[model samples]
Structures are given as structure tokens and as C-alpha cells.
Target chain A: MKPARAAWLFLAPALLVLGVFFLLPVLGALGLSFTDYDLYALADLHRLRFVALGNYWALLHRPAFWAALGHTFYFVAVGVPLSLAASLGAALLLASPLARCRAFFRTALFAPVVTTAVAMAVVWRYLFNTQYGWANHVLGAIGIHPVDWLGDPHWAMPTIILFAVWKNFGYNMIILLAGLQAIPRELYEAARLDGASAWRQFRHISLPLLGPTLLMVTILTVSGYFQLFAEPYVMTEGGPLESTTSVLYLMYEDGFKWWNLGTAAAEAFLLFLVMFAATLALLRWPRRSGA
Target chain B: MMPRLARALVNGLLLGGALVALFPLAWMLAVSCMPPGTANTLPPPLWPAHPTLDNYRQLFAHAGMWRYLGNSFLISGAITLLSLTCNLLAGYAFAKLRFAGRERLFRSLLGLLVVPAQVAMLPLFLLFKYTGLVDSYAGVVLPGAATVLGIFLVRQYAQGLPDALLEAARIDGASELRIFTTIVLPLLRPVIATLAILTFLAAWNDFMWPLIELTGQDHYTLPLGLAAMAREHTAGTESLMAGSVLTVLPVLLLFLSMQKYYLEGLLLGGVKG
Candidate 1:
């Protein structure tokens, strides 16, 4: 049999699945977003009005949409940097020669990455409880007042951010650890021969070589941080005056709960647009700065 | 002496980080074993006053958690098996076969990664609804059954296979399917392990798609059930913690057992890709 023909046969099933289930629905979303496809449209095709861009237009005017967008951006802007720093810090520590019980520490750090987000979020909610949580308990011991973690709008997002950092930093830590390991020990030795300090060696030798890996990790982490749904959903239910309401959480409510399919599709597309632009900017920034 | 101080500082920070990472999970375990309302007390007890299985009993007996557990296992297992086959075949073909437009097709698929899955989700839900798959396991499993990342992972690993070996097998008048099953499959064991672990873990921990698709209580996965249970009974702290323990334990154990393959897949998918 022809290899090409056999290849086509092998590819057929997966391509069919991807096309029908994933790619086609993406196009379908674009179509849905142009109209007011809602619970009314679901019952009868006659009610489906083709109001081109109307959904997007209304979303632009909706203050709730703006607020959700604001909260999501806040999460990405703050969460991404904090997450990266923590991951890099942990990776550096683990990569140190003096570190002991390396395997146990590595697994322990990475454990939270595997646990179900909803389950961990539940645990986190209990831990941050104003009355009974360990967080306030530790604070009280330090002579600080117990703060309402999930109930106060100002504190809710920060608490969620902390949870996000703890849950996620390990994943990137593993990647960055691999990155650090890949850098040759000879370079550091050479730097030391030139009387370079540890910080200077990291600044000059390690940082430059780890640039590509760092950028890649940052891009992946940034895109993932944008899709902040399950945390807000399980932890606060987008409560505390909706301070933790991410764009994806809003999309879930608008599309799934209210059956505002058109508006939700529009919101989904806008999110895609923002994420795409962000990724492109990340890709271009290093090049533009002549790095 | 100076180096000793630095070493101590580094190890101390690592110990602190690991403690922070593992504390919540440990607390969840401790809280789940506490008697009802024990966890809600002041200065939250680190250890239960009297450890008991009451919360687990309530979870299984009253909350009907067993059903959701079964559902999660069934769906995740099916997805892992199904998607592994799909991704393996396609990935091997792209790497080794002489198909027209193979590179272009693979590149286009990679390009699709930039478009968030949520963009397709609303319409995908509608499509599933129209096809009567909304509440079924198929709706949850089918979309996930063949992923671009899975294919990419497999293809990257498969590209290293010696073409001479494949050629020799083909010269022996072996059928393509036979060559794949008998010759390629064994050699692809490492990647197969990686992809299977990745897929099963993702499926088990998946929340959003299942949350949307599985509308009925009977079809609910563990994450969905936990979320619903969390919302409905916020006061049932002990049982909720028990439910969370059940939901997290399987995948946590799987990950611990297969850390090497899982971490390898992450680097492959994230850094290399």
C-alpha cells in the first residue's frame, strides 16, 4: 500500500475530531456572536435575529463586562509577575548544589500542580476563612488582626492571587529548573575565575542563557493566567462585590447560566483577541529591545 | 563559614517553600478527619481532637459522592485510552509517513493553539446540545479525545525513530498497521506513558467543560460535584473537605508515581513547542 494513503488513513480520525469538534465550533462561535442567539433562539429558529456586531456593541457598553475585563487584567498583570518570580526563586533554590533531599522537595513543590483546582480551591477557602482559617490564625499569633479573605472585595482578589501563585509556581519551577540545569557549569566557573560574585554570575551568565526559556515560560504562564475561571468559581463564586470575577467566570455566567449565547460568544472572542495580542507583544518585546 | 551560612539560608528557604506548598493539602486531610464543625473552631486546630471517618461516611452515605467518583474514573480512563490511540496514530504518521501537506497541516493545527478553547466552547456546547450529547460522557470525552498538544508531544518523540528500522520492516512485506502495532508501539512506550499520564490527569482534573456539558446531577464529574456541593452547603466544612480529598487523591497519587514522565511532557509541550 502507498505510504501516503496509509498516512491519510491514520490522520483521518484525529483530523475529523479536531475539525468537527474544535475548529468548526470556533467558526460557529464567530457566527453566533454576530446575532442574539439566546434561550429564545434555542426554542425556535425564527427568533434568531442576525444583528451583526450587536452583541459586541452591547458588551462594550455593559459596565459589568468592563469590570470583569478589569479584574481579569488585574489578575494577569499581578499574578503573572508574582508567579514567575516565585517559580524562578524555587527553581534557583532547588538547582543550588547545597540543596538536600532534592527529589522529595521537588515532588512536594510540584504536588499542588497536580491536585484538582476545584478541590484545592475548596481547601484554600477553608484555610482563608475569617473565623477558622489558618491564615488568620497565623496572623493573630503575629499580633495582626484577622482580615476577611473571601468576604472583602479588596482582599478577595489578592487572596485568590496568592492561591494561584502557590498552586501554579511549581509547574514553571520544574521548567525553569531544567533550564538552569541546561546552562553549563563551566560558564559559572569562568565567571568565578574573573572574580565574579554569585549574583553577578547569575546576572551575566545564567540570565542571558536562560532568556529563551524564561520568555517561553512567561508566554505560557500569561495565557494561562488570563483564563482564571475555576479559582474564582470555587473560591469566591465571583463574590465579595464581584471583585474576583474574571473574564472567563463572567463568560460562564453569561453563556451557561443566563443562556446569553451571543453575548457570551462575543466575550469569548474578545478574550481571544486580548490573549493573542498579549502573546504577540511578548514575542516582539525582546526583539524590539534588541535583546 | 560564609558558604555554610549561604547553604543554610538556601535550604531554609526551600524548606519554607515546600511547607507552604504542602500545608493546604495536609490541612485538607486533617480537616476531613475531624468531627463535624471541628474545623470551624477558633485558632483552627492543626490536628483533629478525635480523628474519625464520619465526614467520609457522610460524603458517601448522604452526599452520594461514590457516583461522582465512578463517573470521574470512567470518563478520564476512556479519554486517556481513546485520545492516546488517536494522537499516537496521527503523530507517527506526521513524523514518518510521506503524506501530502503533512507539514502544512501540522503547522495549521499548531496555529490553532493561539485561539483559546473557550472561543469554541459556547458553540461546542450548542453543537453537543443539538446532537443530544450535552449530558452524556461522550460530550465531555469526545472533544478531549484528540488534542493538538498530545499529537505534538507524540510527533516530537516519534521523529527520533530510526527510518532504517521502519524501512526494513516494510521490506519484509509487513502491513502499515502491522508495522505500527508490532514495531512502533513498543519503541514508543516512553512517549505513550507521558501522553497517557498527561491526558488522564487533565481529564480527571478538568472542571469547565464538564461543568458546562454535564448538566444533570447523575452525570456530574467529581470537580463539578465538589463545586456544586461547595456552593450548596458551605457550612458542611468537614464533608466538603472529605469530598475534596476524594477528588484530589487519585491524580495526586498518579502524579507522584509518574513524576518523570509527567514533567517531561510539560517541558516538551511548554518549552520546546
Candidate 2:
């Protein structure tokens, strides 16, 4: 056989799988969004109505959708900064001149990143138990009252956020460490010669130098944070009266639990649009402001 | 000037941070061995006073953990093997084959990377639902069989192989499949190992898809099993910890053994860059 014919044969199986399974469903989702497909529509196609923009409109005006969106935004607003600060702090400490057992500490901090989220969340659920939880035990040591973490609506989302920060910050910590290492030692030396204090030197030499790395980390974190599902699902089940219901969590419940396929597809697309816009804004803001 | 006592305090703070980070996992193991009500005591013992394997025995006996363990192994192992075969072949073809539309197709696949896997997940569920593949292994397995990133990783690795060797094989009337299996397969061992470990871990830890697809408890994987077990109101702390231990141990060991490949794949995935 000619190599051209042979090559197509080689590519056929994978390409077919990707085209049918991946590309088709993505387009199917776009098509499904235009219809009024729901649990009834699942049983029969005749029940499905072609309702363009109706789902989007309902999502905008509906209190539940707005509440889910608000919950997602609340998560992003609180979770991202805490994660970034923890990562940057770990990276800074690891990059310190007097730091010893550098490799060991690096490994220790990153141990959580490789953990299966499902398993860790299981572990965390126990750790946040209202009565026997170690978190409360530690609080007890400090003479503080035990807080119902995953149980109370007010505390549930924040608890998930804490678990997320612990799970993820290490991954970015490594990236930021690499970013720190790439900065020339001479810049620190130069700053020292000018008698710059530690904080000022960090502001001038470290932050300025890490602009690109910081941007990438923030974008990746924001995207990851916005897709929050597994954390809330196994942790709180969008719980304490849906206070922890993220957009993806809402999408999951609407799509799978309720079988509202059309609305769920809209949720998925809206999430995609939001994330896409967030990334673009992140990339644009730094450049426009000349950060 | 800072005194020696001040320096000691800083080190103490760092040590405390490390301990706090690790204590949950450490305590999980400790509580798993404790007797039924031991961990729930007022003062909360640091070590189990009456350490026993009774909770583990109970988890395996009543909760059917072994079934979930088997489900996890079967799904993850199958995904790893399938991903290796499909990705390797497609990657090699993209790297070495002379075909029309190859670059365009591959480029488009790369474009799909920006769209999070979650975007397709919602629709994919409906697609599976219509096929009656929902609540089946096929449902859990089909969508992930050939990933764009997996193909891209293999292609990038395969691009560097010398053409002269393949040319000689072709001249000898060696079929492309023969060249792939007999020659390229052995050369691509390192990446295959890397991707296999990575894929297996990913499949094993996979939450959203398997949880969505496997509606019945009989088909639940370890993660799913553990999640359900954690929510059982009557479940003792010991049994839950045992479940956590069972779920986490495999991936933890895999990661520790092959940190290099995991990190390499991480950097390649654009998450690190």
C-alpha cells in the first residue's frame, strides 16, 4: 500500500473516535441548547421544542441561576487570592537563602497536589466533622469554639475553599518557585547595594520579574476554580440550602440529577463563556495597565 | 539585630506549618485504627489507645469496599492500556506519517484544549443516556479513550525519532504496523510508561464522569465508594478513615515512585508553563 493510504488507516480509528465522541457532542450541546429538552424530552423527541435563547433568558432572570452564579463568583473571589498568597508564600520561603532541607520542604508542601481529590475530600469531610473533627480539636486547643464547617450553610462554601487552597496551592507553589529561581541573583545583590529593605526588594525585584509567571498561574487557577464541582459535590452536596452550589455543580444537578438536558447545556456554555472571558480579561488587564 | 531566640521562633513557625499540612492525613490513619468511639472523645487522643483493624474489617465486610477497589482497578487499568495503544499509534502517525489534513486536524484538536473537558461532559451524558450506555463501563470508558492532549504528547515525543531507521524498514517492505510494533514501540517505552502511569492515575482518581455514569452502588469506584461511605450518617469515624486510606494509598505510592514523569507531563500540559 502507498504510505498516504497507510497513514490514513493509522489515523482512522482515533480520528473517528475523536470526531464522533468529542467533536459531535460539543456541537450537539450547542444544538441541544436551542431546544426545550428535559426529562420528558428524554422519553420522546416530540416533546422537545426549539426554543432559541429561552434557556439563556430563564437562566438570567431565574433566582436560582443568579444564586448559583453568585456562589461561583464568591468562591472565585475568596479562593483565588488565598491560593495565590499561600503559593507565593511557600515559593518565597523555599527560595530563601537560609532555607535548609529545601528539597524535603518542597516535597512536603506539594504532597497534597498529587492526592486524589475524591479521597482527600473524604479525608477532609471527616477532618471538618462538627464533633470529632481535628479542625475543632485544634481550635479547642486555642480556646476557640467548634464551628460546624460542612454542616452550616454559612461555613460550608468557605470550608470547601479551604480544602481547595490546601489541595492546589502546592502545584502553583512549584511553578512560582521555578519563576523565582529564573530571576537573576544579581538583581537581589543590586538592590541590597542600594540598601533596599526586604519588602521593597520583593516589590521591585521579585514581583516585577515574575509578571509573566504570575499571569499564567492566575489564569490557570481562575479557570480551575471556576470549574468547581467535585469539591462541593462530595463535600457538601451543594448543601446547607445550596449555599455552596457552584455553576458546574448546578450544571451537574440540572443535567444528570434532573435530566434537564437543554438547560444544562446552556449552563455548560455559560460557564465556558465566563471562563473564556475571565482568561482574556486577565491577559488583557496586565498588558493594558503595563503591569 | 535579630537574636538567636527570634531565629528559633521562625523555624518553629515553619515546622508548625508543615505539621499542620500533614496532620489531617496523619490523623486519618490514626483514627482508622482506633476503636469505634475513641476518636470522638472530649479531649481527642493523638494516638489510638486501643488500636485495631476492626474498622478496616468492617469496611471491607459491610461496605463492600473490595468491589469498589476492583472497579477502580479495572477502569483505570483498561483506560491506561487503551490510551497507550490509541495515543501511541496516533501520535506516531502525526509525527512521522505523510498524510493530507494531518496538521489541520491536529491543530484543531489543539484548539479544543482551551475548552475545558467539563464543557463536553454535560452533553456527553445525554449522548450516553440515549445510547443506553449510561450506568455501564462503556459509559465511563468511551469518552476518555482518545484525548487530544494524549495524542499531542505522543506526537511531540515521536517527532524526534530518526527518519533513516524508518526509511530502511520501509525499503525492506516492512508494513507500517510492523514498523510501529517492532521498532517504534520499543523506542517509545519511556513515554508509554509515563503516559500509562499518568492515565491510570487520572482514571483512578476521576470523579465527575464515573460518579455521573455509575449511578448504582454496585458499580462505584473507590472514590465514589468513599464519598458515599463518608455520607452514611451511621458510619463510624474509623471505617471512614479506612475507606480514605484505601482510596489514597495506590495513587500516593504511584506518584512517589514516578514524580519525574508526572512533573514532565504536568509541564507539557501547559498548567506549569
Candidate 3:
């Protein structure tokens, strides 16, 4: 057989799966977004009516949709920076020559990333419990009030953000550690010869060199943080006056729970556009600054 | 003297961070073993004074956790094996084969990466429902069988294989299948290990898709089952902790045993892709 034919044969199963399951559904979702598809329509095809852009328009007027978007943006805005900082701090510590038990620390830091999120979120619910949680216990020890971490609307998103950071920072830490290791030791030595303090060396040499990795990690984290669902689903169930309801959680509820497939598909698309713009803006910022 | 002080500060910070990171998991285990209701006491105990297996026994016996555990194992295990095979073949072909539209197709796959998986989910569910796959193992397994990231990782690793190896095999009149199975596969073992671990951990820990797809109680994976249990058993702290342990322990142990491959795959997918 010809090599091309053989290649097609090799690609057949994977391509089939991707086309049928992933690619087709994506196009189908786009098409579905233009119509009024719901549980009734699902049961009877004739009930489906083409409402070109109606779902998107309805979402624009819906308060819950806007609130969900705001919550999702809050998560991304707050969670991304906290996650990156924690990751970078841990990575810096692990990378330091002064640090001992490097492997142990690295493994311990990364352990949370591999655990089941739903299960860990359950653990966090208990940890942040108002009356009986360790969080309140620690706060009381510090002469602080025992705040309702997951129950109060004002604090629920922040609590979830804290959980998100703890659960995810290790992933970026490993990547950034790899980036840190790749920088030449000579650069740091040269800076020291110039009497540069450690802070100056990091600012001038380390940060500049780690720019691309930092930006890439930022983009990945931003996008990942935007899809905040399982955390809120398991921890708060979008509770405390819906303070923790993320955009994806909203989409889940609208599409699955309420059987509003068209509206959910529209929400998904609107989110895609937002993510695309955010990533594009992120990519362009570094270039615009002549980095 | 300054260096010594700095070293002390750095080590102290590292120790503190490790404690923060590992504390929740450790607490989960401690609370799981505690006699029921003991964890709700004042000054939450770090260790169970009177440890027992009652929670675990109750979890398996009363809560139907054993069935969910079985479901999780079956779903994650099947997804791992099937996805590994799909990714390996496609990755190798993209890396080595002389094919029409190869680069274009690969670029298209990369483009698909930016569209979040959630977008496809709504219609995907409808499609599955139409096909009678909803609330079934196939519904969960099929969508996750081959991911763009998995294929990208394999292709990156496969690109490093020398052309001379494939050329020599071809010169010997080895069929493409023969060459792939005999020559390419053995060389791809490192990546295969990496992909297997990554895929298994992902499938085992996955909650969103399973939650949406598996509608029936009888078909729920561990995460789905545990989430449902949390809703109903909100006050059952010991039992919930035990259930969390059961849900997280398998993947945690798998990751610990294979940290090398898992980390390598993380860097490979993130840095390269």
C-alpha cells in the first residue's frame, strides 16, 4: 500500500472519534444556538423554532447571566494572580540552592494538583466550615473573628478562589521551575559581579528571561480559571445568594438542569469569544511593550 | 552570616508552604478514621484519639460506595487504554508519515484546542441522547477517548525519533503496520508511559463531564457519587471524609508512584504546545 494510504489507515480511528464526538458537536452546538431548543423541543423536533440570535439577546437581558459572568470574571481576575504568585514563590523556594529536600517539597507541593477536585472541594467545605472548621479555629487563635468562609455571599467567592489557588498553583510551579532552571548561571554571576542585590538580579535578569514562560502560564491559568464549575458545584452549589455561580456553572444549570440547550449553547459561545479576546489581548500586550 | 540567615528564611518558608499544601489531605485522612462526630468537637483533633474503620465500613456497606468505586475504576481504566491507543497512532502518523494535508490537519487540531471543551458539551449530550448513550459508560468514555492535548504530547515526543530508523525498516520491506508495532512502539514507550499516567489521572479525577452525562445513580463515578453524597449527607462529616479519601487516594497514589512521567508530561504539554 502507498504511504499516504497507510497514514490514512493509521489516522482512521482517532479521526473518526474526534470528528464524530468533538468536531461535529461543536458545529452542532453553533447551529443549535440559533434555535429555541429545550426539553419540549427535545421530545418533539417540530417544537424547535429558529430564533436567530434570540438566545444571545435573552442572555443579554438576564440578570443571572450577567451575575454569573461577573462571578466568573472575579474568579479569573483574582484567582489567576494569586495562583501565579503562589506558584512562583514555591518555585523560587524549590529552585534555591539553600533549600533542602527539594524532591520532597516539590512532590508535596504538587500533590494537590493530581487529587480529585470534587473530593478535595468536599474536604475544603469541611475545612472552611463556619462553626466547626479549622479555618475558624486558626482565626480565633489569631484574635480574629470566625468568618463564614463558604456560607456568606461576600466571602464565598474569595473562599473558592483560595481553594482554586491551592489546588492549582503547583501545576504552574513545576512549569516555572523548569523555566527558572533553564536560565544560565553565568547571567546571575555577572550581575553579582556588578554588585547587584538579589532583588535587582531577579528583576533585571530573571524576570526578563522568564517572560515568555510567564506569559504562557498566565494565559493557560486565565483560561483554566474562567471555567470554574466543579469547585462551586461541589463546595457552594452556587449558593449564598448565588455568589459562587460561575459562567460555566450557569451554563450547566441552564442547559442541563433547565433543559435550555439553546441558551446554554449561546452562553458557551459568548464565553469562547471572551476567552479568545482575553488570550489575544494577553499575547499582544507583550509584543506591544516590545518584549 | 547573611547567607546563613537567608538560607534559614528560605527553608522556613518552604517548610511552611509544604505544611499548608499537605495539611488538607492529611486532615481528611485523620478525620476519616475518627469515630463519627468526633471531628465536630472543639479544638478539632489533629489525630483521632480513638481510631476506627467504622466510617470506611459504613461507606462501603451502606452508602453504595463500592458500586461507584467499581464504576470509576471501569470508566477511568477503559478511557486510559482506549485513549492511549488512539493518541499513539495519530501522534505517530502526524510525526512520521508522508501523508496529504498532514500539516494542515495538525494545525486544525491545534485550532480546536482554543475552543473550550464545554462548548461541545451541550450538543454532544444531545447527540449522545439521540444515540442512546446518555447515562451509560460509553457516553462518558467516548468523548474523552482522544484529546487534542494527548495527541500533541505524543507527536512532540515522536518527532524526536530518527528518520533513519523508519527508513531502514521501510528498506527492509516492512509493512507500515509492522514497522509501527515493532519499530515505532518500542521507541515510544517513554511517551506512552507519560500519556497513560496523565490520561488515567485526568479520567479518574474528571467531574464535570461525568456529572453531566451520568444521570442515573447506578452509573455515577466516584466524584459524581461523592458530590451527590455531599448534598444528601452534608452533616455526615466522618462518612464524607471517608468517601473523599476513597475518591482521591487511588489517583494520589498513582501520581506518587509515577511522579517522573507525570511531571515530564506536564512540561511537555505546557511548554511545547
TM-scores computed on chain B for all candidates: 0.98, 0.91, 0.98
**In model 1, which residue pairs have backbone atoms overlapping below 3 Å?**
none
Q: What is the lDDT of candidate 2?
A: 0.85
> Stretches of candidate 3 above 4 Å error?
none
Tell me each candidate's TM-score: 0.99, 0.93, 0.99
Q: After superposition, how far is residue A198 of candidate 1 from its true place, in Å?
A: 1.0
lDDT by residue for model 3 over A26-121, one digit each (tens)?
999999999999999999999999999999999999999999999999999999999999999999899888999999999999999999999999
Sort by lDDT, best first.
3, 1, 2
Alpha-carbon lDDT, every model: 0.93, 0.85, 0.93
lDDT score for residue A133 of model 3 = 93
Off by over 4 Å in 2: A1-3, A184-201, B1-14, B164-173, B271-273
- Going through the candidates in order, the fraction of native interface contacts each one reproduces equals 0.89, 0.57, 0.86
Tens-digit lDDT track of model 1 for B55-92: 89878887778899999999999999999999999999
Interface RMSD of candidate number 3: 0.8
lDDT of 1 by residue, A1-291 (tens): 989999999998899899999999999999999999999998897999999989999999999999999999999999999999999999999998999999999999999999999999999998998988899999999899999999999999999999999999999999999999999999988988999998998899878898999999999999999999999999999988999998999999999999999999999999999999999999998899898
Task: Provide C-alpha RMSD values for all models, in order.
Answer: 0.9, 2.5, 0.9
Error of 1 at A141 (Å): 1.2
Judged by DockQ relative to the true structure, which candidate is superior, 1 or 3? 1
Query: For candidate 3, lDDT tens digit of each residue in B152-243?
Result: 99899999999999999899999999999999999999999999999999999988888889999899999998999887755489889999
Between candidates 1 and 2, which one is better according to DockQ?
1
Q: Show pairs that collide, candidate 2.
A: none
